[model samples]
Target chain A: MNAPTIKPFGECGFIAQIEGFSSDVDSGLFANAVARALRSNDGVDDAVAGIDSVAMRFDPAHLGVDDAREMLLDATNNTPRNTARAKSKTIDIPICYGGEYGPDFDALCTQLKITADALIKLHSTAPYRVITLGFAPGFVYLGELPEDLTAPRLKTPRLRVEAGSVGIAGHYTGVYSLPSPGGWRIIGRTPLALFDGRETHPFIFEPGDEVRFNAITPEAFGAIRRAQK
Target chain B: MMAIATIDRPGLQTTIQDAGRRGARHLGVPQSGAADRVCLAFANAAVGNRWDAPALECTMTGPALSFEMDIGFALSGADMGALLNDEPVGRYQTISARPGDRLALGAAQAGARAYIAFAGGMAGFAFFDSVSTYMPAGLGGLEGRALRTGDTIGSRKATMMAPVDIPDTLRPHFGHDWILRATEGPDTESFNPKTVRHFFSAPFKAGRRGDRMGLRLIGAEMISEDARAMKSSAVFPGTVQCPPDGAPILLGPDAQTVGGYRRIAQVIDADLPLIGQIRPGDRIWFRRIKAQTARQTTLQRQILIASFVSDFSLR
Candidate 1:
């Protein structure tokens, strides 16, 4: 479901209005420019660039909201950004599609106008770059899927989307790395835990990493889960 | 050194907290720390612990706590009729407790969040560098949820902590007067002058759904400028996001990493705890403060906290 449209946000901490599309090029360029500016800016922290908008945080204690906003304004408008490949990554995620693991497996097939077999092939064929990580921790949004595959989110969010459930919303496919309420059309599940608190790097995938998902069988998934435990 | 407090009866959303994950935004994690930070700091000071150490962050109604070891503790913020073994344990003052003494709190007489601090910080395993519980990821503080009956936590004697010397005159007392300061926002222009005036003039209520993420305030329906199809963007703590429904949601410690909604204002850093103490049905007014003033105040506050450690002896 689409959130109702409204006025633009904030004045100083970030830019007010900017037009950028969802196309790979538009999204990529906007993200890159914002990221570059944030990297260059001395005042900002937790600087994040999205598909069309960029948001950065600073200790309002050090960089006043006015200064923070102005800094972002300069980055978005005055500073020219480099349009280059995001830090490339080849993260391999082992998944279990269809059957019980993917409760929405059959649902995705019906919605996408394709069979289960074709759906998996379409998804696995592409190498998706990380669009953004928001909503929840370790939740990775990857996409630019086939247009026919695009659809709105569920009118009602599911009560519980198990960790590792892969979903699609508005041409974007995402994997839930934690258990939480979600609305995407889940098409598969991954056995390998995407989140590792024990890892030196807790976040398995970053905003700029490149990713390719590999499918696995349910039995193999069970064995992997057992071995990890 | 372990001091135990048995939960006689657990109330709503009481959990362990401290200075939450300080630098987790790079990993898309919202810092889920103490809701009312000022009170937590004072409570820590009262109990002879570091200001950043973990403590029990209790919401409106908290559980009846019974101590199982000889220890000292204090409660700061929100008078909830707290008592030890049916006798009152003074607010903002250190109180000694014996093993098996029951401590209880009733309805809040003032604020929303109350801090229960011990001589030592909350005894819990660390996650991402702090013990603040981020419930979404199930990290930190006793399985990342509320404290329940039979939950036992240990504490170590504070090594560097000194008895807080704040005078009673400076302590917060229940009052009806409060004015919050906010910094300018990118969307300030979008709001008509009349609407801006209304925002400052009207009294608003913190919605019932308020939590660590953000408190949803029910006020005048704010209209976005010319109706724009806002693209999804990054948001931060203290961001005041106005959804199309016209309601204002002020982001807090656990605010989202990104949002597609329009933002109207960002609360100045110094006055954030003001929002934290705002309870449902409480009224508040806003004033615009220059960022420079806010930055200066932030430094002053930090210096004030830094001055409390008794071991400020030359290294």
Candidate 2:
């Protein structure tokens, strides 16, 4: 594809947009190319790769915006078409579906006019891509759940969503790394810790990684949680 | 006595902050740091510590800390009517404290946050190579949360130094109203030119719900041209996002790494210190400038900050 247009994100930031990634069909390849290039560029201190574009944040103290813009533009022009895919790990998250762990399971199934078993099967079957990470540390935003399973956010958010709670909103599914107030519809909960600062790698998943969910008995979930302690 | 101190009373939301976790934005980590870097640096410098040294960033209400050893400390930022062992102390100056000395801070008569710096900085565990506290995800500082009463914080090393005060001319002016400079949009085109114009000229009051996450403004709604939800994009501390409902949410230091709303403008780095002082009900005004001008202003501010070496010249 052609080089993306570079725009000023803020005074010290720049966004390189690869337009129409939503329908481009090979948007992931383009996004990965930009993310890899910008991350390795010394002028750019941090780069966040979104679904279709990349935002580069720079320190004006060391690198001026003009210089940063040039380096980013140059990087995009040299998009490595033959570059290998970024290193990724496929993590299998053990989840307890449709019970006390999923407070809104019955309500969600009823609203969507689907059977609990069907909903779980559909959700567990697809491998979701990690689009962009944000909202909280290690909070993975996996996307494009089959159109049949897309759901709107709760009108009012829950006061506290337990850590490990797996939920869906719009076309995205995410796991809460910490207990925080959120509006997504909870479908299940995971026994594995998504984030732990003490670990060599704090986050279990990174952007561009693939994730699959596996249903487990609540008793198994309890055993895993206990062992994690 | 060893190099240690006890929190007699942890007022409001006091937490330890440093320069913040860097180079981790791609991992969705917020750049959690002192709300007012300028003041934090001033406090640290006064006590002969590095600019990014870990220190207590006390909110509107301040904490009451009692030392367990002789220590050198400095208080900066808002005027909190501080006291040392019941004797009134001052802001922007380093004071030597005895083992039993108590450093107490009263309600902020001006500004919204206060910073306290100890010599050699506070001893704390690091998450992602920084001691700055990110409360949302529970990382960094003391157990990744705000300070509490009965908390005992230690220091690896302490130094005894003579008192030094920042000159009045160099001190930041904290008040009920503030004028902040900004650079218009990564998403300004999504907004009507008229609304963008209004945004720069309108008077907005800081809403009560604001925290380190963001400052919600109430006044002169900024409407977008299409009002459609945009794809989630990168956002930083100073990003001013205009949601569909038209109200602007000016992000703060603890803001999420990305957002989907239309980010109409970004507050300049030079005037970011004013962000920490913006209290609920404070009147706010924005002035738009070119990206080049914002960089120039920040450079100028950096030069001024560097000149603050005067406070440490006596050492």
Q: Which prediction has the highest TM-score against the true structure?
A: 2
Write candidate 1's Cα lDDT for A19-85 as tens digits. Answer: 5353753454556466655765565556665566566665543666666666666666653433435
Clashing pairs in 2: none
**How much is the lDDT of residue A76 in candidate 2?**
67
Global fold similarity of model 2 (TM-score): 0.94
CA lDDT of B180 in candidate 1? 69
- Residue range B271-300, candidate 1, lDDT tens digits: 676666777777766676665676666667
Error of 1 at B218 (Å): 1.8
Query: What range of 10 consecutive residues in model 1 chain A has the weakest lDDT sum?
Result: A1-10
**What DockQ does predicted model 1 obtain?**
0.40
RMSD of each: 4.9, 3.0
TM-score of each: 0.86, 0.94
Off by over 4 Å in 1: A1-44, A59-87, A98-114, A158-160, B1-3, B156-158, B174-178, B191-193, B296-315
| CA-lDDT, candidates in order | 0.71, 0.81
Q: Write candidate 2's Cα lDDT for B202-225 as tens digits.
A: 899999988998999999988888
